[model samples]
Target: MTVKPADLLWPASTARLAIRPAVVEDLPRIFEYYRKPEVSEWLASHPADLDAFIERARQPELLACIYVVERGDIHIGDLYMGIRDAWAQKEVQAQAHATQAEIGYVIAPDYAGQGYANEAVAELLRICFEDLGLRRVTAECLAENVASWRVMEKAGMRRETVTRQASLHRSGRWLDGYGYAVLADEWRGSLVS
Candidate 1:
């Protein structure tokens, strides 16, 4: 099944957040945090300017995967969930289509350490497993980014791997990377526990 932005029930809520599809108006608030060096350092790629950010946000493909994270009227950050096919041998490849997704998030600095990331991620996992019917969901971060990995763990995703020097940072240094994942059954089990 092909997943689109419309596939998700918009304004997905956690205790303190409203996660919804990205709109043109939301891009500026998102860019506010993304433009910071501290935040941009952890991301694979970020817009260089407001215009660039808006331009990228306007794309149909990107809008489908990106979601804005908000606290009532405040824009606190953003989340991403990209659906993709899982690995399968030739004979079973069709069964793997859209069976997995990669999730990610960015919280504004002022909102860091407030459990917002954890709450938002837990909801993302719910959407991946319960709503999207994905078999598995995964996320990755630079190993040095302790907070990012911690959120994944808090959301019940297991640490799958730690690859040495797997990512090149904008600072011209190679960084170790950590991967975390959880299967649909595993996520459901986590909820029951």
Candidate 2:
């Protein structure tokens, strides 16, 4: 058996949030965060089973890095970066390239509007394009998820389109998602003098 080092992205904010790789020890707090109705409603069709989510989120091969959003060293919410395969993501990351990594995140209702999601995403995008050598990163949010869209906007991502996709929840209904992205070349060019 072998273990690889996971990249833990750090947030850029003065608030109490400190982004780092989530550990099994953080599950209790993570559970509490996901219990928020507003935060979880748009994410899936059914309610999150806290114990199940925590157990699954801890698996290493998930290609997902769960992050703990800590404020004053207390775990507040969660931020995750799932290493999806394909520019469109269908379980084939081997088919993807440095220019087309996809990403997503969530926040507890308690932490919403406090800029935690914005800061967490900035850190992930930095790691995606810089540390991971990804050329582009995409995010998809429901058409009505204004807060999520705003987060993408604040992170410099532009919405590319809106399309219907099968919902991931009990809604059992089709949902429209707004695709957004940021390119590494563009990010680099902006930093060039």
Candidate 3:
């Protein structure tokens, strides 16, 4: 099945967060932290300014996958889960389309180390494997980002790979990267156990 924002039941909740589709009004709050060097430094790409951020967020495709993470009235962060084709041999390539997802999250620095990232990511995995029926979901981050990889581990995703000098940092240094993933059956089984 093709995964889209409409495929999810909005306001998906966890113990402490409400994960809902991002709206135009939420762009500023997202940009506020996303523009910061500390936050943007880890992201693959970021908007240079608020105008650029707004422009990028307005894209229909991106808006569909972007979700705002809120705690009551506080907008603390954002999440993304982009659906795509998983790898397949030529004969079975058609079966791969939209069968997997790549997820990402960014929590406000103020909310860091408070377990909010872990909580939010767990919800994201549930949304992907349960609501979206995705076969698998994966995430990657620079190896130096201890906090990010820890959240992935806390969410029950296994460390699938660690690549040396696999990514280029904005500061002109090659950085190692870590990839993590979980299959749908594995995720579901974890909940039962």
Candidates' RMSD to native: 1.5, 4.6, 1.5
Query: Compared with the true structure, what per-residue lDDT tens digits does model 1 show for residues 77-118?
Result: 999989889999999999998899999999999888899999
Q: Positional deviation of 53 in candidate 1, in angstroms?
A: 2.0
Point out the higher-scoring one by lDDT: 1 or 2.
Answer: 1
Each model's backbone clash number: 0, 9, 0
Model 1: weakest 10-residue lDDT segment is 1-10
- Give TM-scores for every candidate, taking all chains together and pairing residue i with residue i: 0.94, 0.77, 0.94
Per-candidate local distance difference test:
0.88, 0.68, 0.89
lDDT order of candidates, top first:
3, 1, 2
User: Which portions of model 1 show Cα errors greater than 4 Å?
Assistant: 1-5
Candidate 3, position 84, lDDT: 83
Q: Which parts of model 2 are misplaced by more than 4 Å?
A: 1-16, 45-48, 85-99, 164-173, 190-193
> Candidate 3: RMSD over Cα atoms?
1.5
Query: What is the Å distance of residue 135 in model 3 from its true position?
Result: 0.8
Per-residue error (Å), model 2, residue 12: 8.0
